[model samples]
Target: MITPLIHYIQEHATFPLSETDISLLEEAFIPKKLRKRQFLLQEGEVCKYIAFIVKGATRQYTVDEKGYEHVLNLCIENWWTSDRESFHKETPSIYNIDAWEETELLLLPKANGYYERVNIIPAFNEMRIKLDDNQHMAVQKRLNMAQNYTADYRYEELTKLYPEFLQRFPQHIIASYLGITKETLSRIRHQHLKKAS
Candidate 1:
């Protein structure tokens, strides 16, 4: 039942886990699934779990003072998602996490032999390095978008980067993730069509 989980982890990790380490993870990790658009965490709520996506897509987003949503990330299959500030510091979250499609995730308890058990696993440090790398890359990407790109270029980058998203998520959510209004996204799409003609 957990072979998919193990395979996903192994594929993503730079260091390999031993059979015993794999066995220990299967015992310690709690598995779950959420239907499309279900909330995993809401703003002002405590994030109680760290999740690795086993399948499907989820997003972490913030609601503005005017109650408009601004998406931060879209976590696809084999990705990890969480309200990091809340999950790590054990504080109330400033963001909400929800599924974009029917999703499966492995929820690891903060207390569930996390570092202590996984430290013995060869894959542990590899996982940490990747996580850090992803976060750093995300920051650089966002900065580039803010500093150098037009909204249309950003939209194009997104489509190229995550084309599968078009079939799964609504336009407004994608627009928010791109830091543009839906109207702007519509205009951008129109421009793209014109150029392709």
Candidate 2:
């Protein structure tokens, strides 16, 4: 069940881990299950856990003053999802995270000393920097698209990059993620299908 976490770590680690290190990792993680529509974190709550999805899907989002949801990220198998600032600083989160499907996760609690253990890994710094860099680049790309691309263009780009997202997530959720109205997303999908057919 924790194979996903192990694989992600191994793939990103700058140096190979020994059996002892593997045992340490296994000891540090706690498995959790979330039913569909269940919230892992809510706005204004301090996020204490960072979860690695072993199965199912989740969405991280925030609601505006007018109560419109704006999705920040989506996670499926092998993805990590968390309210980063809240987790690190023990501050209230602006984001909410919920399971989109019945989800299994390996969670690391902030007070568990997992970070100290992880830091001892030979390539920990390298792995951390790489993950941070990738996330920063992804955020920049999304910001650029939001500023310059039409809803249709952004939807197409998202589909091209994550072909299964359309099928995996509800249209309304996808529309929110793309910062578009559901009606607009429906129109875009209809037009694209018509063109294809």
Candidate 3:
């Protein structure tokens, strides 16, 4: 379970990790498994841990007054999931995070000195910085798309960037993630298929 995370750190880290660094990481991250549809974080709860997905999928979403879920993020293998604001500020989250499939995660909790302990590793520290930068960029890109792009264009961009999502998640979930109605997504898919044909 930790192997994937170790590989992820190695791939993203600016420097190589020493044996002691690996031992520190092993001590910091706790492995957990979630059944499909199990909640990782629920609305109104403070997020306690930042989860790194080793296998399977998860979604972070919010429910409206009418009880319709709007997906804010979809995460799969090698992706990190957390309500960062809730985790950092110790405030309640408006979002709910759940497993879309039986998921394996390495959770880094705030309770212990885990963060400070891991930060001693130069490679882990650099990886954390890189993750923050990439997350910021992704958020900005998603916001720009939501504000300026058409539903068709958003769907196209999803296909280009995360084509696996089309296969892994349901149409309704994909539509919610794209901020479009399922009907509209269906129509767009039909049109794209026609063009491809």
- Which one is best on TM-score? 3
Best by lDDT: 3
Per-residue lDDT of model 1, residues 123-157, tens digit only:
76576677779889987988899689999789888
Reference-based TM-score of each model? 0.91, 0.95, 0.98
Per-residue alpha-carbon lDDT of candidate 3 for residues 141-193, written as tens digits (9 for 90 to 100): 99999999999999999999999999989999999999999999999999999
Compared with the true structure, model 2 gives a TM-score of 0.95
Candidate 3: segments with Cα more than 4 A from true spot:
none
Candidate 3: pairs in clash: none
Off by over 4 Å in 2: 123-125
lDDT ranking from best to worst? 3, 2, 1
Scored by CA lDDT, what does every candidate get?
0.82, 0.88, 0.94
lDDT of 2 by residue, 30-137 (tens): 899999989999999999888889999999999999988999898899888899899989999999999999999988777768867866877644666788899999
